[model samples]
Target: MVDPMKQFWVTVAAVFVALLIFVALPVVFLTGAMVSAVTSPSASGPSGPVVIELDLRGGVTDQAPQNPFAMFSGSGLSVMGIVDVLDRAQDDDDVRALFVRLPEAGMSPAAADEIRQAISRFRRAGKPVIAHSQGMMQSGAVVSSYMVGAAADEFWLQGNAALQAAGLQTEEIFFARAFERYGVEPQFEQRYEFKNAVNPFLQSDYTAAHREATLGWMNSVYLSAVANAARDRDMDRTVLQQALEAGPAMGEAARERGLVDRLGQVEEAEQRALTRAGEGAETISFASYAARPDTRRHRGPVIAVIEAEGPIVTGTGGSASPFGDASTIYSDRTAEAIYDAIEDEDVKAIVFRVSSPGGSDVASEQILAAVRAAVAAGKPVVVSMGAYAASGGYWISSEASHIVAQPTTLTGSIGVFGGKFVLSEALARFGVDIRSLSVGGETANLFSPADEFSAADRAAFSGWMDQIYDGFIQRVSRGRELPIERVREIARGRVWTGTEALRLGLVDELGGFHEAVQRAKVLAEIDEDADVQLRRFPAQQGFWEQLGLAFGGGAEAARALITLGALANDPDVQAAVREVQTARARAEGSHVLADEPL
Candidate 1:
């Protein structure tokens, strides 16, 4: 029989202790873990001979988050990181060789070219580089993985792996017929015939001009691939082209056909690499090697590498979701980064890396304005085109002091198109109605989905498109220093491969990031052989700030944070989210180029 008051106080204390153990303790543990990861020290240099192991299965991006916690967050490797590692290895005496594990799916052609160029440079430093592939499939243009492997001194494929070098192809889906069945109509117009971005919503099949433009770029990319593979394997171009047409070769057939150097498993490839690296050599993860601190110090002018990737949009670029899922180029964010570089006295020049199919006209203009401002500041601006840089992508790129692109880079779609879909009939089919009232302007209802464009609307819209298209051509003519007539000849919304673009005076050179960097160095009046530090933008946030953004405060933020966190951890969910975002973007009138294969 205990006293009542004492018993009540004891029970309250027990409940409080239980809450701390069950709830607060776990949160504290996680927060501490995050802190520890962020504050961890960088790895030191290797003491013995090392063969750097690069696993490309995770794919590569132009810029990866610099947050140390990014490793725990499952972010993939970056192209610049890999290039930096290779560059470091070239000068590191303890770095004996390089061993790469190629992925089943192919990378983007431009990305592969950049990595391949780095590998070529590594080999030129007298270090042997070997590539191992379990299987290579015809995913996303198919020639990418092989192109990267061709740069290696030795290439090995597993006995069960098949070589699917099926070449490049693209498909377009039309929804005009579907829209008709659903009682919806798409009203759109473009500046010219070659601007086929709107064709998916206007026609059921490819128009003549659309077919010509598509085939022109496709043929250029295909021939480049065939020629590259042939040159790498020391085989006849015609024979290699014929073999690719008859591909899907497996095991010994791949080696016999000169597609691979040897037939073996990954272990065998590792043994070969180890043998070449000599006794006492160990295989080290490339990530860990890259993280090692550089004891050597150099005081040199900084060359900033600012990346503009994904669909361009207004405002600061970030996933709206609470979890830091993916990134895109935002006009304000990019312009701010450019302004930062321009203001930095240490930054001598800038290399703007663009990987986009293009988006909003206003957003593109905003970024173009930043480029112009950078030039006016007396800092040299060089554009490095990656993957699909066309239309709005070219819009922002035109004013650069120089432009560099991979031979297979799809670019040069200088065009504009816009319109609204009338969905009133579709809603009526579902017994729903939309009513609108407007005041003050004749074309005030231009974006209203309930009404189709009137004759006046069409005329006014056409005039607007003509103005944008003319402005686009003038910019290109002025930037590229081509005659207005010559620019017009290639301007009509036509797409060109980097090779063709170089010939048409659209791009300054056909090369990868290394070449672009060399050009930047020369433009800055720095010696090509001089060592310069590369500063990236936008600047990385601190640990606590990143955590705050990742795990939001308040009840609503918590719910979204939890949901997004779950989605980010699930690959299937992430993929679904991407598909949904792409569909939504298209529905929202994002103008992506037709040549983007992904």
Candidate 2:
């Protein structure tokens, strides 16, 4: 009696809708899951071989990406991002090799050294490292490229490509010569010889001693790089030096110099990748891992990753400052965080993630002291270092029960450096003078707006730094169980790779954040299978931090955007930014002794 055709059409429509719900949704998710797994894949292959390609694109920094959507969350950079790739690649049993995609990073001489040494570690792991350079390198990127080239089982570059392995050079442009011609008189105050950060404003030609020191440091870095390259690549130092002097070598020139292991195109390189990594190299970019999973069924002891980044500063009178995460580093907030963590019985242990280049000394002491309190309260503390933890950074970590570092993490650089700028003359030339009057003996000792630091001022500043340096030596000495003499001998503000640091006793172990946490658990005597949850402190963002994000962005957020968008995407811009940032940070003012050191 009913229309049979109409009934059949309705049934067909229902079946189609059901198929959409069941088949379509899964297909979409699976595609994303797979996409996130491989940046580019060909044909069907196993979901294995995760090689962290180091386009080492930007000027390197301690902090990097932090995604709320990420399954493994951290308030700061995916500090473990590099490790995530490394662990998966090695553990998969299917992954046969690691393809290190290094590019010109436009970094400072010292920065390059850090990256190069990091690559050496993967090679030593028994896994093959294949380094390929599609572009040219000069400063930091070159150092990383050469380092990987040396460390890798094989290093390749395009046949037509040029390698601009420019030698190191540091030239300071003085404004005094130009300022004087404009009838400008500059004024400033006391500091050390090394405080010549403001030299350009005061002098025309470089100070002989200052120039010597700078040159000496640069030369030291250069020789170290050259020697390491020669040894790693099986080339002679003389040969390497010649190649460096003659920048941008191509084809046979590169081969003859032994800078590259082979001359090959991207296709040949991939074929090599397949041969070494076997059939599993497809998932090299897509897989991810973290120490703990998000979903937990039961309540249990938690091991939290507390990041201590940036300059340590004293509390702004219990005020919640904008800088809270380990990246921005406001010491008062950090102290408060530590204070809360020690009291929280749920936190079984603490793995303090430290990556800083020193800040305020007072802050450093406060943070370290808080950590000591936590240890006293029965919670063991382990320090996990990232790219760097020098000066005041070392101060806090020195007190940890144990420390861990990636071979490339710059860990040492003990000792303190503080200085001020006397830009009065430079400004006056521009018809702008900074006038200041002060009361009390040497009240304006730091930034005397009147004139350059008299010899007496320099002596005073130097003496103060001496005392702080001595304290730093003793603290590290005691914490590391070494003699003060030995600490001082190696504490001349020289940076070291995490591997070097371990040998020097600057760190206790060579691993990433996971190792630190695992060690913390072992030290804390927690059962391996005990349920754990990360306990966050200060449990809220301070007003200023929120405001900063409202206006510009939080430090971490800005850095993420900067690295991903601006820094990574543009090489020239990255270099300019690094030069400006480093220069400005050095010239503006200093917490050398770390106003908030830790």
Candidate 3:
């Protein structure tokens, strides 16, 4: 409607405006990326020289660290941080020795072993490691001290404190009676004579099978402690146990009992340690150590450390607790991550760092498939098992080119179980009358929102479980190079230590995470002199996490704050909880996680 010249001018103006907006968008994206890039790498480890202190608080769960890595959604001690510290300590000749101030709680046996391994490797350079604590040490901290204690020139404890190896005990929080009281019927199917995954939800007391299995593990843990303490003390295992039962050393009783080398505080302990190391106590706190590039000869090939932490679920919705609490739906997210690692070309070898207690069978299989893909890609996949890697954990590790586990790592539960709980009676009691109908079977969709599973459905579940059991046996046998019969004979959901697992042919080697990485290096024909840059495939943060950081990252930083970086949830307990929840919800209603059909 206007003049042609004016119209042309308007069009040109609009074009210029659009160009400017597009440029501005890219600049915003770039800015956010830069901030994220700067923040994430800096948050990994502290920024100083090495002085190590572990803030050991809370109940020890399967999860290693409980702090979230940025918005990476998981909890537990900073395992990567631990690894980094050990690596630094080992390489730094200036750093003479390590000191254990005091851990707050009793660490899990597995964590104790991890810490012990790190200390031992540090001491390989023929340096002293000292433990000086006023608080009474729990089994975890005490046992860890023992590993390096004998080698240390001196071991010191507070005058009033001593070792309290309470031995191992298992307590199942049974809500079975609770379920029955609430009018919910616990139902399940387990094929093996000893598959007891559903025991806590069904029985009021330990089944003979469950009792035997539990006792076996407890005995193993106890005996190991006895041997460790006795060997270091130059005494017999029986004598040590008798001493422990009598009572942990009180005052001079600890030194007299040989439970401790001396009764002293930090200053005296440091003096003794100095004598042992042929130098003054080189005091260092772990907090001061900064993240530096790994200067170790890289061996020319890069081994990608894909942290397979948290629950092996269907999708990643973690950060609650990576290892023990409910994190991801069983097996889903793990499979995706593994597949992604496999696709990265720069990754010459794969280090599947497992810290899971296992999860869904289907999910486990999916992860295995990704590992197989990596193998097919000419990348030899090696596994580094963390604390509890049993059941589905073993399922994935069984086929690795090599597997490394700590001597105290709990593993080797080659088992399968399925169950459900029906709440029909509870609903009826609540006066919520419900009815439903289905066409195909005697109790199709019985556990629908409007119905309860019929007797027929329960029977069908049991029958289906039998098939799954057979398939599980076959898979394990093939993976472990055992005959089907032998696999069945040992396929009860039973836990085992790394040492026991090695003997049972369940693990390739009794070693720490670095050992696995080294093996991968050898298998990949990496030259010993080549540079090895450690790469970690930590969890990628989510959209909201990015947005929040963008809005107030500087403000949060301005508070002059420091974050607790290392922490993870127990993956084992978390997966178990997820499994229970999935089964119970399925029994409650059919449509929530609809797998079959509406």
Candidate 4:
């Protein structure tokens, strides 16, 4: 008879091998499938003249994730992807024309401008682009939507749809009164008056400085939008502005007023585009065409495009919201990307795309340091400002070799504010007791929610804000080569449009991503007309790599490991395993345990 202990050990070994195979096979198969899915092209080019169809109802993003799975899953169309695909389509012989539908309301002003620029280039290449609008509803940035439609070679509006692209309007809500009624105190300090981000908490209405700054930027944006649309439609700016200012009009009235070229259903507009494309023409979704692999390889100097989109934060990973997913500029990751570009011999320049409303001061500083390092390493760093690059956003871009902004991009707001909402009084009324215990000095509890800032705390916080503001001014002065006093005049926590910012010597160029790339080319001594390979830095992680990261460590992994260890050590588990093993061995006519019945 075989030694029972030896047989038991062999049985356990066999079960362990079987368990490994059970778990490992599926993982291997799944990984292979994922790899194949990600590597394979989403669409292959068809043999015909294709009218690229783009539907903007899903809205546009600044950039899409580099992951192929995400790209093909309708993650959403991105502005840069559209621009790049259009640029390619210009040279594509089979691409006869573009048929695009504008979003119902609007997209980001800067994003719309970029798409318009791309369309303009495609049109210059002797291709027709037709844009259709269901309606220019009165919603977010209606004028921007009209600007895009106006850029197309042919603009179409749905019959019976209203042209509500009147102008831009803003509504502000102040929480001071509400907080006062609720017995909650909002204690805050700002470097100066124009920094009105905290004004909602401090005042019942817009202060003189706040109103002045708000209107200044708003007027500039309004004029720029009208001017752009007027130019696109080949109409007199004054006449178009007057007509739009008169009021909303029906589709026919809009056509008569020269805002749109035709009034028809979307289908009719699409048929017109196809008819214009000549016989045997076909239509392809814009996403499908964009997913086609590019056969052309650029053998020029590499320009690393680093995206720092969303609020500047001091850690890894992005944040999610009900509105949508917003990619945060994690300091460590962003800085690492900059450093990688600086060290890469093939990369001659860096185009840092900044789209943020600002966040942590330390995080912004970390990214700024990397930018400076890139410049010092002889790599030209050019900043391409996105929708809104305010406060910390501007901070990181302050020292770039060149700064480019869209005409309506919001920049500046070079100020700092800090404070908290004290809920002690409000909670007390609700019979909710909140106590604070700290061992440090008076200002140690500066951010304690239960206590409002004392006079000393306020003084201390104000001084800190002043220091941050001064640093911001100094950096701007040094970067822009402006006098400190001049920087001071433009600072004061005031936000400025790219147009006004350009006028005040704040931004280097008023343009979009394409222009920023051209500036980078010029600075890197590369031929301005030559195409350069744009390598995106902080390259997207592979699926398996990401998977490993998810399960590798942290609190979850620790808990899982502990639970697994405990399960393995439990006596009941061991006994159950032994019984199962003995039964399986007996069925196979092999001994497992001596005490088991034979």
Per-model root-mean-square deviation over C-alphas: 12.5, 16.4, 14.6, 11.3
For 1-598, candidate 4 gives per-residue lDDT tens digits of 7566764555455344334533342232233333322233424435679899988888777876433234334447887788779888999999999998988786788888888889999999998989999887787688888898889989999989888877887889999999999998998888789989999999999999999999988788788889998998889999999888777879789888888899899999999899988899888888668767776536778999998778888976623221235567889989999999998899999999988989999999999999999999999999999888999999999999999999999999998988899999999999998888778788988899988788888888888888888888888898889999998888889999998889998899988888999999999999998879989897755443332233333333334434443443355643554466556658999854452211
Q: lDDT for each of the candidates?
A: 0.79, 0.61, 0.61, 0.81
* Best of the candidates, lDDT: 4
How far residue 550's Cα lies from its native spot in candidate 3, in Å, is: 12
Q: List residue ranges in candidate 3 displaced over 4 A.
A: 1-51, 54-76, 137-153, 229-239, 267-282, 290-299, 318-333, 427-443, 446-455, 527-531, 538-598
TM-score leaderboard ranking: 4, 1, 3, 2
* Cα RMSD for predicted model 4: 11.3
lDDT of 1 by residue, 144-247 (tens): 78877877889999998898887876799998899999998999888789999999999899999999999998788878877876787788999877776786
Native-referenced Cα lDDT, model 3: 0.61
Q: How many backbone clashes does candidate 2 have?
A: 21
Q: Which stretches of candidate 1 lie over 4 Å from their true place?
A: 1-47, 65-75, 294-297, 322-324, 549-598
> Local error of candidate 1 at 406, Å?
1.0
For residues 468-488, write the lDDT of model 2, one tens digit per residue: 777777789888899888987
In candidate 3 the C-alpha lDDT for residue 388 amounts to 70
TM-score between candidate 1 and the true structure:
0.83
lDDT of 2 at 441: 73
lDDT of 3 by residue, 294-359 (tens): 466454556787766655666444323322343342355556666666777777788887877777
Give residue 450's lDDT in candidate 3 (0 to 100): 55
| Each candidate's clash count | 0, 21, 57, 0
Candidate 3, TM-score vs. the true structure? 0.74
